[model samples]
Target chain A: MAEISFPLPDLGEGLIEATVLDWLVSPGDQVERNQPLVELETSKSALELPSPQAGKVIRIHGAPGETINVGEPLVVFEVPDNTAGIVGTVPKDDAPKRRVRLSAVLDED
Target chain B: MSESTTALLEAGARDEQSVKLSMQQALNRALDEILSTDPKTVVFGEDCGQLGGVFRITDGLQAKHGESRVFDTPLAESGILGMSVGLAMAGFHPIPEVQFDGFAYPAINQIVCQIARMNYRSRGTLPMPITLRVPSFGGIRAPEHHGESLEALFAHVPGLKVVSPSDPHDAYHLLKYAASRPDPVIFMEPKSRYWQKGDVDTSDAGPLTGARIVRPGRHLTLVAWGAMVARCLQVAELAAEDGIDVEVLDLRWLKPIDAEALATSVGKTRRAVVVHEAPLTSGLGAEVAQLITQSCFDTLKAPVERVTGFDVPYPSGDLEDEYIPNIDRILLGIQRVLEYRRG
Candidate 1:
């Protein structure tokens, strides 16, 4: 078995962080891929996050009523080797970059 | 556009190898191309992100392009328009979707005063290349606010370019062309024909400016754009039974009004009928009719006529059929123009 850590995925619409409203799974619970592992509340709405892989929950990083930064580790799971990167977490630097420059076009136009 | 580019587009439009798809599907394909080619391009509006838009025009975009390039915003028209101004000013090609034609009023001030005047306001120092997609026109049985034709409101503004595509083919090509421009464009989609299927050639399918002669005739000219184009075509087909051959001109580019193509058609037909879903008074039809009268005064056989919606708020869904111009109403307008004789 290999350990996989799941970070909070970008909830989109400029939401950078969300509150961990509740955990749907506990340590040692068998989970299937895309199972709701936790519920998160962002500025927009409440969302249930699915498990990225079929695994055994090793640890829950945050408890209920805790806020988590996007890309920060939120859960740890032990899964079979072939299914290790099933959800496929990219490194922070390798993640798709958002538009950060809005003022640069003015000077050139 | 250069002559070569124009020739290329004509070839593309006439090419038979194009894939058949609905207007909405073609729009999706074009958006996919726009996002794939341009790193600076981004699309957003209410429910545009996770929901892929109410019409599903932006469906699968957020997932494919990632949330950064395709995302949603709050339910504020002003904020969306205001933000687009800044984003366009910053050299990004931002395609902001106005949920519907009626919903655009809340942001009209920003659209008219700011978005339209950005370049002129700065004396050419700023070029706002924003493509605002607004699904407009009636016939969908959509509620009152959802089915209005307000293209004339934008066409009246000087700095803005207005375009409405009549079919799936033009919808894909015109949208891509609008997105690539240096100035702002109001891309109006006829919601009624959103699902109508047609052949769409990705290669060089003509420039965004000028009119297209969808049907050729020698007796009279029927001028229309957007949803009315289809109705006008139907009118032309039915008018054939009466031996009144009609020429149908799709004014794809509403602003920078394809005056040359329109004049040529009116001059040939000697009689004209302008059709629109907007109210008769101050509608784009009025301008087209005036242009035809001025250019083809000697060739005219009768006074130019207009078939349009009444000057009232777009009525509820039940009455929309009676409100918006239909084929029979258009044929009547045509026959009225054809029956006229100089005293």
Candidate 2:
């Protein structure tokens, strides 16, 4: 399982920080994508921070009434899928060398 | 797109509510609208519900539409298509998706014999209004059997209508049109172009079926579909550097190809080049060349040419660079057609 951290997104207008109003999801709760993870109060209004991805909630960075800076970790999620396996590969270092001269094709004319 | 996929419009209306979306998102929205509008329509395929497909084209659709409408099926491609045939027979519009272009092979019998000929065999009684969504073509460097261009195989079928959208707008519109058709449509979704973002006007659509002349030019016509349309557009740009005007045509429907569009663009330019990912031997390019020849032979400046994949089996991702026709190869084909002279 991979632990992914969701950073607090800048909710427009060059906002710097937001106070955590309430935690809608607990640390052990499994959440769906776009689910309400936490409700935070911004300078202008209070809004719910939705989970960016669906995963098991591993940890919460801020408690209620705490201020978390923009771009700071909001919550950590443990993703279940392990996709490391045999798939397509682009070997950047071993890119196939290719060269074509139009002279050879044009010679037919 | 540094060069956007432009549909050669005839007299289509444009909408004010255009969203910059990827082809996948456009398709998802189209499916959502299809499910919402048509209560008889059903969408099901392997891993399409929970995992939201390997490409995530069906993401959040299952939760939104519920299990009965947008559900997952068994891993069997044949079974999925067979079930689609049965569902269509029961007066339902079945929009079944095969994970990849290569995966459609297992369901060929059900697709060709049953789905293609159902209406004809029943004398227009039982119509198979099935839109088989296949993630097609190779550019993502996918492994063997993960990327295959099966357009020719499907297009050769008598009753099947094959379509591959070059951009998100067309992807959104053509899919909804295909789902609404009474006949079966092999909707080839260019897997590589899924993430290519473009402006999708969800309001109104242009022509339902026909090749779109994305770039209008006076010199020559570059005909292509699916992933190759974008590549041909890129090549057209490169060809422009050499002062060669190239008209890029997106052949939307492969079965009943826009012969008039081919005739119009090629008749105007008098030179044509067909590009495709399928193998050169008996590929759809051959048919396209013949069509251009038949239509624009009298006014043609040069013979029709084809730039395509090698005759060998579609290889794994490692050899894709060498297998699939690159921009240079297409440019070479264009050059060949440009320099052709009758001996």
Candidate 3:
């Protein structure tokens, strides 16, 4: 299982923190990308935060009414490892690679 | 001739000629002229240098002034604004574009805390003369976070001069004036009307800190700014046909509003209506209404009315025409105010 982490979005002209209004999704619930995850209030207006990944929410860092800062992790998701071969592994330089012909010719000629 | 007389003569000759140009083109010309005339003036923002900005307001400026003077910045709004504050403190006139009204949120902290306080914090020893140009308003059918009317937020902040231009002429002259001022300015350009052509007489352009009366009427005064000024003009024409004389006043400088013009118009008309594209609750109209009532209480024949957007996140593009105050709403507001007979 791969862990998906949610970061606080930049709000209010370089503002660092925003008060959490309410959470729409709870731990263990499945969420899709761009789905409303939480409601937040800034000095200017109230905003809804969207989920960044499609997965089950494993954990929430803060409760309702708590202020969250930008770039701070807000939620964790368990995503399926679809590209297991590429996950956390470096490509081997010695592996056989395919070569492509720059020009094509007719065999009859 | 004396120096003042010579200057006046030169200005008079310049004012007589009218030039027709779109709002964005006029803004580009103003930047070109200012950058050419002042060595200390600099323009920097996202995609502003080589790309000439998203709307091309800064087009051709990079080639004319070079990259050092007119250059593109990273996609960080906060960094752009904070850097402009430092440049201003160092005695350079920095005009940073926030790209859009919604994107300006990332620079609010730097603007409110740093740029706004630098002058007062330094006790006038260090002056921050940064001009932040933001293209604002709706009706362009842009995506989310593109069209927002947040002028009230900047106007509420101290040490910041918030100005919005209604047309090409105001856009050109106000930008030049903002560059010359010794304080941070939030210069809001009407995004939707950027291509609307208008006649601009570079000579007749006035100072940046005053208001202009666009239409003269005797019944009621309608105060507005930015693109709403143009809408108010249309409303005035319609009202005239309806037999209601309405005066349209454009508050060019939102922060240091023209109290003289406001007072005079309201005193004469005795009835007033404040209109804007922003929401009704706590918008700039609130402040304008308070000021009018406080200053022209005895002269007011009716309570000031406000026609503005609802207190909700700007709706989808399809509903924007209904969401924003339009000519019909203005006419309704005029009718409401005219019907108010003090018992």
Candidate 4:
């Protein structure tokens, strides 16, 4: 199993920090991807942040009413080693498909 | 190159006590070092305080430097830069962040009028010792304006120095060096390359300004900046197999460009291709091409070729691959320069 630390994502554009409103799930609870993880109150509005992956919660950071900065640790989860538990760009896993001699890629004209 | 620049290049070559660091980590470390060393230094932007920046380039900075020195500001880009001007005037080396390259648009009034001209306007009595950090360029499929390339816009200004780092070592040292400069420096961080990991020497004071030859080839030269530097290096490697020896030059500084380096490189190879993510016309590539033409005109083999984005608004994620100059486009550019026939 691998443990993943999920940071508090940018709740809104131009928002740097958010107040912890409530935790829907406690540590040790198994959660599914996109499940309601916690409620955060930013300057823009209050909303529930969803889980980025399916895993068992290992740790939860900040108490209700406590504030957490964007990118700060929000939750820790335990999952299979092969599973990725965060959001962002997808990894390039396959061998580049366009491998050819430089001559082949260039045009004669 | 001067003695210090050569020393930095050599130190990078030596790779002493190097540690693998992503551009994000490297920039963070550089900011940490700057904040700790300079008592007057301050870092702030929207979400940069406790949030550590939208991309987390300033991650954990507020905790380490404390809220007073490293804190967040309102979403107002103008306010952020206007405060930087005030902070610099008050003897503080204000290191303000614009959050993203696109966000800088709103701050142009402050950036161009105040930060870029305070030195000249004040007759150098009060120089804006500020480093405006903007996570620049595109590849992560961001929305419109989020991935804009404004090097030409910033470079056009008189009193500002512009730079972008292609790797971790340069990112680490260049950020620290920019903060140390007496003049305001627009430090453009390639957004897509932030997650890239490479060996960075924390002590390496990378070139304050000037281009460095990352790869040397005898047949032709591929000149690029920011994310395009890495792409050029890759093209050079692939070209090597096709019997085309391509030299890769990273133009670290956009303003006060190292004309000497351009002359030296194109002078030897006599063939050059400049690539950038910005649009074709009025891009920084045009200036570089002019510089090469002016300096190495007599010895040129063919006109300097430019493989750049279309002359349109920089597209968002879905059209990024189409907009950004790809390996195929660059290879064709190389072929054009390498197989040029004098008419």
Candidate 5:
């Protein structure tokens, strides 16, 4: 088993911290990738944080109403060995990688 | 072939493929050029990344630079501008868009108090190298709060360089110039002209300050900037039918008002008229008139006349045409200035 930790993302546009409103999952609860794990309130808006990796929840960092700064570990999860190198449940092979090149001039007559 | 002939031949060939771009496309090219050349340059604002901005000015920038370099921020104007200042202080060039002119009011506190004053207050020790992009002026028939000509508000603040491009050529070059400057700059785009097409010579980019005489004349000087510039030019052409020679000057930079160029034009023409979409009370047009009065006091043959919007909240699209100065209103200013006599 591998232990994966997720930090609160920098809910952009200068928001540095958010208060933990509620935890959707408890310790030992199985969570899927991109699943809402916690509800957080920032300066003026409420946001739901999704799980970055599919795993069994091992620990919840803060209680309800506790403010958490960005980059702080919000949750820790234990995952099977097959998901060790994988981020979330999406396999690297299945995700199509695309690149777009923009030319100096897009259109010309 | 002679050397001069060879140069002429090259110029002729280059003129054939010279791209005909609108103000929106010019801005895209400028942002793409900056992003491709400089890794430190980051662009962000509401819908600027994936959506290519509300005006589509940043179209395809994210596709070219990737989400890390070019991305969208939240709808909060204050947050976007405040973070841009921080990013600049941390040695990054931030191009933060304010979406529209009216939206800029929410960010005015951070813009005027923090970003504008940082360089001067730090005694030049710290530099806020930020370029704020704001789409301003009326005529697009946008809803309320989307078309306020609030250049005067930003121009009132010292240490801030405010620039408005009258055409696509200036939009492309001036945007790059504003981003490259060490001081903070407010790059106001005339949104109404975003679709207006013109020939953009990519090779020649001029200084940030100084006025450009779009049309030269000897009878009267007509001063305007951004969207109003086109109206002035049209009015000048119409005035010629009556044998009134009118010169039009595009005051590119607002904060550092191009007083010398304005004075020179006013001195020669002897009569001056200033036009803008903002309210006449302390509007940018008033500042230009004051400058003309101060510099060309002895040379002036008549008091400078101003044609501007009334001092009231910007109305909805239905009434915007009446609020914004048109050719008829501009002609009134010209006629009033021409009719004035020394006491």
Candidate 6:
């Protein structure tokens, strides 16, 4: 068995916290990778956060209406080793930084 | 003097003195300078090629730098943004223009999911350094949806840095800085003030992340950005007549906000009011209020009041005055915060 800790996914605009609107899963429930875990709301809009790994629900960070900050663990899971490897290794930063070069000729006046 | 000599003297005078340029011209200058300085920089957006953008901010750029560095794209915001991400990933600095604030909605999916999440999803392996230029706000009597303040929406997205310039000088320099930064930046230009004049002294400007104390005061601190900074300054001037000293803070960088600068002013003033044209509920004020409460809780003299647009879709052009926050609303909020008496 492997322990699964899911950090709060970025809700957008570099927001740090989100209000827990609703929870789709309960403790001891089986879940799959990328499964909807909970619904959260920010100043912008309501968003559904997905599970990063397939596992059995072990714990939740807060109840509905509670505000959780980004980077804080939102859910805990118990999963098989293969599932745990994919879930726990998810990247924290979502902004792509790869650099490429391009050339476009402009029309003159 | 002879006619030729007179003409030559006038030309010399024009060259000797700085030309009074509109906000769009300032933007052109900045883009032109950056592209000339760095061969890696390139620009693309709708009508940006020969037409020089709808607002003409990109005018003369295609001619000066040649299409190799500056060009136009099809009328597709998502396509523009997606291509920018692809170009940035390949190592080029692509500055895509979203013609108007209203037109940017179609690209929200790409911006929030692809551009913003790319860097974090790739574990820092892929950095989206593209700059999205969104000219927003009202006062120019534009049609519906054209004058929207969606900064809060962009600010809430992680991995995206949101920046707005209240004047021309910052517009020029900030765009340059955004081009150079490693993170993706959403640059919101205030449409109403595009023609408003301000001095652009390149030597004194600082980095893109810092905030500016446009007006220094002690009674209360007014935090604003974009065009609202101009409003705050106006309000501060009026507040002076009523013996209210209001410190105005222009939060140039909305995301990764200048917490220290904000705390310092709020700490001194012991009162605060946030102003913006976006809807009041869950606006940027919510984040700022939380930050002030957590960091400057002990310095509190009053609750942090937010003077923002009503929680409604941006209204028709005629009813915009009611939907957007104005001097009267901001002044009223300031009065409420100042007059509050603890029981």
Best-performing candidate as measured by DockQ:
4
Ranking by lDDT: 4, 2, 5, 1, 3, 6
What DockQ would candidate 2 receive versus the native complex? 0.11
Sorted on TM-score, highest at the top, how do the candidates line up?
4, 2, 5, 1, 3, 6
Best candidate (score: TM-score):
4
lDDT, candidate 5, B1-343, per-residue tens: 9999999999998797477887877898999999989899999999888656766677678878999989989999999999998998899999999887889989989999999999888898779999999988877666777788888998889889999999988999999999999999999998878776788888766565689999999888999999889888888877776778889999989979899999899988878999999999999888898999999998787789999999999888778878988777787777776666557
Per-residue lDDT tens digits of candidate 2, residues B103-144? 999999999889999999999999999999998888778877
How large is the interface RMSD of each prediction?
24.5, 6.1, 31.6, 5.3, 23.7, 25.8
Clashing pairs in 5: none
Question: Tens-digit lDDT track for model 1 on B107-215?
Answer: 9998999999999999998889999999888776666578778888999998999999999999999999999999999999987777667888766586667999999
Task: Provide the interface RMSD of candidate 6 in angstroms, 1 decimal place.
Answer: 25.8
Better of 2 and 6 by lDDT: 2
Tens digits of lDDT, candidate 3, B1-343: 8999999998778767678887877999999998999899999999888656777688779978999999999999999998998888788999899888899998889999999998899899889888899988776766677768989999999999999999888888889988888888899998777777788988777655688888998888999998788788877876766667789999988998878888989988888999999999999999999889988998787799999999988876767878888777778887778777669
User: How far is B94's C-alpha from truth in model 1 (Å)?
Assistant: 0.6
The alpha-carbon deviation from the true structure for residue B236 of candidate 1, after best TM-score superposition, in angstroms, is 0.9
The TM-scores of chain A alone, one per candidate, are: 0.73, 0.73, 0.71, 0.74, 0.75, 0.72
The digit string of per-residue lDDT tens for model 6 on B1-343 reads: 9999999998776555445555666888888888899888889898787656766678678878998789988888989988988888998888889888888899999899999999899999989888899988775666676788888899899889999998887888898888888889999998777766677765545666778999999888999999889878878887776778889999889998889988888988888999989888889988888888777887687789999988888787668767777777788888788767658
User: How far is B6's C-alpha from truth in model 3 (Å)?
Assistant: 19
Query: Which regions in candidate 6 have their CA more than 4 angstroms from the true location?
Result: A1-109, B1-20
**DockQ scores of all models, one per candidate:** 0.02, 0.11, 0.01, 0.18, 0.02, 0.01
Best by lDDT: 4
Q: State how far residue A15 of model 6 sits from its true place (Å).
A: 53
Model 5: CA > 4 A from native: A1-109, B2-7
Off by over 4 Å in 4: A1-33, A38-58, A61-109, B1-16
Q: Which ten residues in a row have the lowest lDDT in candidate 1 chain B?
A: B50-59
lDDT of 3 by residue, A4-92 (tens): 45678677586888888898999999998789999988777899988865789988877888987886878887765331111012111
User: How far in Å is the alpha carbon of B156 misplaced in model 2?
Assistant: 1.1
Predicted candidate 5 versus true structure: per-residue lDDT over A1-95, tens digit per residue: 54555778889989999999999999989988899999999997998888876789999999999999997888877765333112011112212
TM-score for chain A, prediction 1: 0.73
